[model samples]
Target: MERHCVFVTIFVLILHLVQAQNQTGFISVDCGLSPPESPYNAPQTGLTYTSDTGLINTGKTGRIAKDFEPFVDKPALTMRYFPDGIRNCYNLNVTRDTNYLIKATFVYGNYDGLNVDPNFDLYLGPNLWTTICLVKTGISIPFINVLELRPLKKNVYATQSGSLKYLFRMYVSNSSRRIRSVKMGQNHGSTQLNSTHEP
Candidate 1:
């Protein structure tokens, strides 16, 4: 009995260690930033936010954030912008057969001082993720976070409406696969299926 208990404890420890490693697979992007710029100061979030200037091959610089006090606190995250485009994308290498919580945050600081608010769309590769409306301060816009049982191969993209400029952030949260699909978009629909992994 004692030997069995020891074996069970060892198995539990190994399972916990595997879970810890899986939880570390995450990516955060500070859109519209160039190299040598500091990362967003949010270590408490356990995610590293990096510049997206050279990371992707689209988007034009429209504004900077040093002038806005709301952005000054998270300079790396807010100090850049991506103007309207068909599809601005970033390709990332993630673990195969894993699930992820993909989140994109937008804040229009009116950096251009134009006082104009705009709307745009977000995408996950060929999939039409959702649309985002940028509003001024004191007003909150509903954001979307997609839970994807990401195929071993996939890409993420962002689209703009060409009406106005804005700044945003992208966060890819990793989690163990539980459900098949969780959809959040204009259609308001969902489907589920069982996933099987072979040894």
Candidate 2:
């Protein structure tokens, strides 16, 4: 009986240790920014983008833009990449021995909310990216909160240590509603995700 208890305790301890190694970090926006003009002008469309009013460059520069502040209740914000979904992107620097827990959130006034894969397509270095374990979204008073598209986790081996440059982005097929705010959690480099700071 004592031996059995000892084995059980050892197993539990190992499990806890492993869990501790995978703590997540948060990614939020500090400023909201917009591109001076439609970034897609290359396609030769007449669509023009205002510095803070439109979605051409939806970053910290946009959120803090004079016109964009009302919808931007929080300094940390998110942008919905529509027409060309998953096209809304941001760069993050990571380290080797750590994995990232990436979560994407969206909001709506009244939306069907479809077409968000919420996966890391581009990795700065060797990635520990994998498995969409969770996907969930719901409504709050002012807007519907769509979050946890996937509780995805990645593993970085010992050899994979140091700075990693990456892009975390997503898209939506239909334009039901666009809530431009999301929070990201990380195991390392939380400061890099600070949106308003600038590159």
Give TM-scores for every candidate, taking all chains together and pairing residue i with residue i.
0.46, 0.25
lDDT of candidate 1 vs native? 0.40
lDDT of each: 0.40, 0.31
Model 1 bad stretches (over 4 Å): 1-23, 38-46, 62-67, 71-80, 127-199
Candidate 2 CA-lDDT value: 0.31
lDDT tens digits, residue span 51-131, model 1 = 655455544443334454443324333433445444344555555434344545445555567644333344443222222
On lDDT, the leading prediction is: 1
Residue 163 alpha-carbon offset, candidate 1, angstroms = 30
* Top TM-score model: 1
Clashes of 2: 30
Show pairs that collide, candidate 1: none
